[model samples]
Target: VAAGPAPPGTAPGGRRPWRQLALLSGLISMDSSESSVISVLFPALRAALGLPLSALGTLVAVGKLAGMVTGPLWVMLAQRVSRKTVLVISSGLWGVWSIAAGLSQNYVQLLILSTIAAAGFAGGGALVNGILADLFDDAHRGRAAGYLYAGVAVLLAVVGPLLGLLSEVHNGWRYGFFLSGAVTVAFGLLVAAFFRDPGVGAAENPGVGAAENPGVGAAEPHRGGPARPGATVLNRAVLRELMSSRTFRLILVQRFANTQLAMVSFGVVYLVDVFHFDNATASLVSAPAAICFLIGTALGGQIVDRVQRRLPDAGRLLTWQLATLGWGVAALLATQVTWPSIGIYVVLFCVLGVLQGFNPGCNRPILMAVTRPETRSAAFAVMLSAESAGWAASTLAIGYAGSAFGLRTAVLWLVVVLNLANALFMTLIHRPLRREALALRAATADTHPRTSGAENR
Candidate 1:
């Protein structure tokens, strides 16, 4: 179909953007399946490999550290190829490494293979975020992100218990890898056949590719020439522009300061180790917490969208800051203070999950707002890479600290304290975020004057 201006309240992907969103979410879901399996089944892994607690940290760290480099590399690769091609190869076809990792009989082999798989998985985040920005306009980006992540959370909720059940069988973690790898490969095939590129800036300037709307769509001028495969390369000027944005820089710092990943990565292990629960019993928390997180994302997305409609400038940022702060409080209560029952812990974790959902629903839309469509993939690549580095550092620190001190104390300091600090740091972004967002709106109006009437609302 010819690309042109999308109708009001419609996405550039035509009438069925949710279908595209679902496919993208399914692809992105595989990105973390391997890591989740490793995290959830670490007890079995530890027993089988005679691994130390710190080894969990090392394994997770290696994958994340690999992602820190490979994430950006994949984004650059997408520019050379196409986002769909790179996404399929990295997120889908790379499942072969996952299967190989599952076959490993030793820690070294497992680590090496999983790292290779992770390098491929890292490609999905930047490419998907960039595409989503083009698929939906700013007004609905939060809801789009919410639905995408909520889908992921739903899968995690279902899979978490199954992995727990699998832990009961000898070498069941291997089966988890095998299953994840197979499913990912299948999804890759589906994406290759069905997924459509909305073209860069298609949502913002929907009139793209129309007779009168020259220099838009896939070959939009600001994004550089036509949509020839392998024609686009890394644009250094765009990178510099991204770096110059005070809001973008502050967002990077906020992402780097995030340590909440450690909470999810280690929560199951903490219950198994500290609370003396079996794997099956400990995993019960995962399903409910994930469900709550799904609710959080769904609700948070709608709430942020409405708030932005009213406040525009401060809404999303304020919501994100408050959510971060709330998550820290929940983490402290869930971790630092001992509860008498696992049920209590479950309820608290549900609260944590809900608060956790708010961050992505808010921050992702903010990132899209502050960036030009041309620079979005690179922006997300850098931002997500920073987050990967932070996750690696936090996981490693918690692992060693859990050994040196205790998991309880380590959780208290790293997850709770750092999250609180990050929330406070987010305050600095308010002014810059407002300024940059307004500037982007003005620029979009100038570039697509015909759509300015609709966009100004």
Candidate 2:
């Protein structure tokens, strides 16, 4: 009841601290930022390789697909190995590969190494989000995550342009991997050596990994289980639970549709071809948006925790989605308005950044709520699969559309349509969110009878 932490030796507030949450959050974020980082090198790559326009385009798609494949392998391995270790190793590998990429001999070598490095980033991301679920209370996980990613959004905005500027001078694009890899390895070592996951109800446990029900005593050391015969098959129970729960499905679908719209690889080129802005100008437009996104994420996380404390089943989650949906639509519609100056584009971009900010704040908390703590990693891996698929498909679709109908038309159609479809996804989980809200309330009451009276129904 007090503001003081649950106990010494455990995660803060019986959950992890923001610093404790950083390594994975930081490392994983770098993974999903291919759009920002890889784009800086494209012109250099084309000039050096003497490749056609089509060849340059294929690099992006192939890299993402490779990431998707590698992601689940990491998640599955997490069941057998420490999630922390996998992330650390992957990030280490990322560092090595990034440096290797910078020194590649040819197009084929560069392409192969690029895919491998990005895949490490993607898999590492899944591990970090899973760690968040393990370390936090369901009530507060979303907001906590919001803070973590808000920090990342800021980095993307800031580092993205710096990477571009470096690319311009002294062939820095070739060395991008070297810089990223060195930093990544340093981060992985620190995290592997020190990080932990929080289990609930354990008053004095450090949060490297949590117990199934932390409100109780420590769990028996996982000595032995049924001979985990088959290759730890993708846990279907994780899917069934999500499928049965409306909130889970809605969040996942929203994530899917949001990515399909302006959120996907679409942003990198949309500014370039449609808005006819130079790369530096596009990054300039994007940077403010990144700042706004960070603000939105922090706000979302704080608000989610506050609102739930009062109305356990408030429509705040739905509200966030609706706002995001509007932003997507507005972004598409913004394309229609002919902006005369870099100033106008900056204004629109900042608005877009605000909308982008809403996602890290709103989305992950919902996913954690829908899946129980134990299966959080698997649940996220499944969603990661969906996210990767949406990214791949959207890239392909937009590519064809741009070649045929024009970038402007493609952006317009996808943005508006995906916005509406994504908003409707919340409807998919309507009844389930309500049901889960009640179930969570009951569970809370059963565990903490004294606090139940303080919690509003």
Q: Pick the candidate with the highest lDDT.
A: 1
Could you tell me the TM-score of candidate 1? 0.93
Tens-place lDDT per residue, model 1, 168-212, is 999999999998899889889988887776677767766441123
Q: What is the lDDT of residue 374 in candidate 1?
A: 76
- Candidate 1, overall lDDT? 0.83
lDDT at 306 for candidate 2?
74
Ten-residue region with minimum lDDT total, candidate 2: 222-231
- Stretches > 4 Å off in candidate 1: 1-10, 13-15, 209-232
Residue 41 error for model 2, in Å? 4.3
lDDT of each: 0.83, 0.61
**How well is each residue in 1-457 modelled by candidate 2, as lDDT tens digits?**
2233345434533444556776556766555444455664454455666754344446666776776788878777765655656777876556778777888777899789877887777776666676675555555665778877876776677776776576466657676667777767777777766665443222111222243323221122322221111112355765576577767666666666654333435564566667787666665655666787777787867776776566556455765666667776667656767778777777776677666666655567666655554556666776776676666666666667766788677667766667667776666665677678678656756754643443332
Q: Note each model's CA RMSD in angstroms.
A: 3.3, 5.0
Tally clashing residue pairs in candidate 1.
1
